[model samples]
Target: MFNATECIEIQVKSRHALDGRLEAAVKDLQETAMRSRTCGILITRHQPGHYTAELSDQVPFGITRELCR
Candidate 1:
């Protein structure tokens, strides 16, 4: 339902909830992004500061991280 764009996969999780759910969370985000034809996706935790992770598509992880940051 949405156009593909270069963006990170942002997920919010607390200090406790984030444990043992990284794969599921990232998979969900990737699935959602794929449905929307998203160009890329990045997985990160919920925190007060900036963070970056690997991207799922052609775009480099660093570039996506920089753009999101």
Candidate 2:
């Protein structure tokens, strides 16, 4: 848990393994992206006094290729 004013950074302790038996994942949503077998970590940032957060899922790539450099 984090406080409103906290400046926090999180690192993925492990690479999430893909579960073929897991439910289908949506390639479009950040949440779904987070749940992706390829995803590494989900991150969030918040402002002080207000725990409003920004969440991001890191896919870093699609089937054929990742986003262009």
Candidate 3:
């Protein structure tokens, strides 16, 4: 089983700067969640390949007006 929670993440890609990019993504994800009405539980992860984004089951992506704020 997997742990579930609410979240929204913003991810960016970097070729030579993996650590830096992950760090930035974590910060960006927090900032993105903080500025909105979200509960601010975004989980940021860095992979060996392309960067990616995700929203949890409790916060699935869709037409949520508050998500923009």
- How much is the lDDT of residue 35 in candidate 1? 62
Instruction: Give one digit per residue, the lDDT tens place, for model 1 in 8-39.
Output: 33344564444335445455556655664644
Model 3 weakest lDDT span, ten residues long: 60-69
What's the alpha carbon RMSD for model 3? 11.2
Q: Which stretches in model 3 have alpha-carbon errors above 4 Å?
A: 1-16, 37-47, 55-69
TM-score attained by model 2: 0.19
Give candidate 1 misplaced runs (Cα > 4 Å): 2-19, 45-69
Better of 1 and 3 by lDDT: 1
Instruction: Give per-model TM-scores.
Output: 0.35, 0.19, 0.38
**Model 3, C-alpha of 50: deviation from truth (Å):** 2.0
lDDT of each: 0.45, 0.27, 0.42
Q: Clashes in model 3: which pairs?
A: none
Candidate 2: worst 10 consecutive residues by lDDT? Answer: 17-26
lDDT accuracy of residue 30 in candidate 2? 32
- Kindly give the number of clashing pairs for every candidate: 1, 1, 0
